[model samples]
Target: MGREFSHIARRCERAVVTAYRELRDGGRGDLQAFGACTTLYRIHHPEASMTEARRLVAEWIDHHVVRGASSPTDGCDCA
Candidate 1:
């Protein structure tokens, strides 16, 4: 995961973290943000299928953003 994500800059890391937190919150708005990231990933990597992009993002979220089952405010720095 580190190797694949080493290229991400600080801004992107923050955005990914935010997306992971929002998804965990569970609501239509949060889902939209999650979908936006996936959608952007698809647009940027047009050759990649949506499912693959989604899987990659989910893996990234699980590995880096959300490792354990903590409270909604536990892992994220969002207030």
Candidate 2:
């Protein structure tokens, strides 16, 4: 499981990082933020399928959510 996530993390690093930063700065709810990220990704990668964009967004969200949960005082209102 960890190895799988590591592989995914490497594959989607750019999208995940950009999406996380954008969503965090925007301070929007998960659904709205994820949707916005997906749209932005699609715009940047027009050839990319919606499913791929959505999957990247979902993985990014899950990773950050878990990270935030682990660090309650990271100054990110993940709570």
Whole-model Cα lDDT of every candidate shown, in order? 0.54, 0.55
Q: Quickly count the clashes in candidate 1.
A: 0
The positional error of residue 52 in candidate 2, measured at the CA in angstroms, is 1.1
Model 1 TM-score? 0.48
The residue-by-residue lDDT of candidate 1 on 9-77, one tens digit each, is 444444665565656666646457667767755655677787876776565566665464222322222
Quick one: how many clashes does candidate 2 have?
A: 0
TM-score of each: 0.48, 0.51
Off by over 4 Å in 1: 1-29, 68-79
Q: How well does candidate 2 match the true structure, expressed as C-alpha RMSD?
A: 10.4
Query: Clashing residue pairs in candidate 1, if any?
Result: none
In candidate 2, what are the lDDT values of residues 28-63, reduced to their tens digit? 776777788788767766777899778756655666
